[model samples]
Target: MIQYLWFDLGYTLVSTNREDVYQKVLERFDVFRNREEIAIAYHRADKLFMREYPGVLGKDSRAFFPWYIGTLNYFLRLSLPIEEVLEVQRDVARECPIQWKAFDGAKMTLRHLRSLGYRLGLISNWDESARAVLARNGLDEELDEIVISSEVGIEKPNPDIFRMALSQANVTASESLYIGDNYYDDVVGCQKVGMHCLLINAYGNRGVEELSYHPIITGIQDVAAYLGHPRVQLEINR
Candidate 1:
């Protein structure tokens, strides 16, 4: 009975090309950290930043860079000037949109869902760059609406953003399905708003079969079969 489908952007629709991003950082910025060092520092900082701003959405550069850079500096144990850190942050912000790529079958899955008459939209905890990334990857036009954390000033793991997305689509909570990669943000958030959610454990890294309020899918293409589409059944059998 779902009439609307809303998806999370990062790790769901498209993911950052971390290797490329790391290479760019090393080449463009003056840093002594090796690739492995940077990777660990980056993940630690990223996780900390997400924790700090769980329900606030905006561009990472503008809203979350300060804390991220601080964490990076600590991890690297380097006393970088604020200006240098800001410069690096800006570079990351600029490069991410260009480097992000949609997952295989993402567009096909979205188009398939649209053809089924289920309204498609995006609910992301990202900044303005997401629009460009989506447009560049041919996903922007396919969505009926996009609610970003930066634009709405509310982030995932908060029911208000889910409410906003539903309001924009004019769909009731019970009539919508929210899909995302993060358990706390997508599943917990949407469930709080009384909406059904599906987790996208793309690599099966979660090691979880199900949640109390939602199920899990390995890919967007699998969503078709989950929804009982005959075409998807054929695809699955093949």
Candidate 2:
């Protein structure tokens, strides 16, 4: 029986409007691409980094963004200079510092799970800005505990962080379930601590299916159904 539920921040509970941002930046370079095209390209690039680079996304932005945008451009087949795009992206970031927004049904699902008697928490490999992002999106109050990498000086895939969350929640690993988008960080990290985990592959073909022994969900909204909560199903039907 799972009494506690934990989550990853990026691509799990919240995500940036990468497609919109990328589209706008591309337009400045006179490069034309639809939002769907940009989104697909970004998804491919993101999966490559998540699988190959592992913790690159959690690293310093100065290095990470250039590499990421370069890869995204490859997938998008864009010839625009990477540095120019980065400059534009920085401007966009400054104007909209909080780019993350809760995914559709994220807050509802989390609150619903809390109401269903599960302790909700967050274990994310993110900078100090994570708390502000959660609060801005109204997700902070729904979580009972939030353990971020920068704050604790520890990151995921290390058993210590998972242990920290368990200690804070006062629950054994067996009584908890962690859900996230990254397989290496979320699934493998949970395995190290003897905790069950679920992967969220919104695109459905991110190459994790072959590597993951655990269940994979499309989004946070599927948690109630996955956990066998009939009330959520009933509400959805009506």
Q: State the lDDT of candidate 1 residue by residue for 53-142, as single tens digits.
A: 554333435675566667777866776676765676567758574378887668878888888988999998887787998998999989
**What TM-score, over all chains together, does every model reach?**
0.67, 0.91
What lDDT tens digits, residue by residue, belong to model 2 across residues 105-190? 77878888999999999999998899999999899999999999999999999999999999998999999999998888999998
Error of 1 at 120 (Å): 0.4
Candidate 2 Cα misplacement greater than 4 A, ranges: 91-98, 207-213, 231-238
C-alpha local distance difference test of each model: 0.74, 0.86
- Highest TM-score among the candidates is held by which one? 2
Native-to-model Cα distance after best TM-score fit, residue 144 in candidate 2, in Å: 1.2
